[model samples]
Target: MTPHVPALPAMGVVALLRALLKRPRRPLPSALPEIVTEYRLDRLPLDDIARYRAAFGFPGEHIPLTWWYLPAQRAHLAT
Candidate 1:
């Protein structure tokens, strides 16, 4: 496999995204696929944490809310 290339093709990725997209009023499937993608930050540096906190008004242990999207988007593609 080429180091720079992903295993899934662009069309496949687009189809997956399309399939996962839904309107707010639509009901999600009760049965879900047994796929999970976990994304971890080994460490959030003190400087970065402080910068994020200062920029976003996150005072303490709470991370930026948007951070959750990384793993969620990963989970979407994995399935």
Candidate 2:
């Protein structure tokens, strides 16, 4: 069985703006295979980190390991 989660209460216009302001900004993590590629797992040796940064212009540290998902997909397709 799945667990139930509570939803946030509706906020008034002013309150909604305030809530949004208070919310923290989090950088999105890169896809899974990108992470694996960046770390050079297994024998693939794909340069995910460099490619992602070049394509999206993300700062070095903010790049998430998730980016490896692309390479993983390609590997699966090849098989």
Per-model TM-score on C-alpha atoms = 0.28, 0.31
lDDT of model 1 at position 48: 67
lDDT of 1 at 77: 85
Give, for candidate 1, the lowest lDDT window spanning 10 residues.
35-44
lDDT tens digits by residue: candidate 2, 7-63: 988778998789778955886666655434233456544465767767877666555
The per-model lDDT (C-alpha) reads 0.70, 0.67
List residue ranges in candidate 2 displaced over 4 A: 1-40, 43-48
Model 1, span 1-79: residue lDDT tens: 6578656655777777877995578789999989565666676566765686787777677767766665568767865
User: Where in model 1 is the C-alpha error above 4 Å?
Assistant: 1-32, 57-79
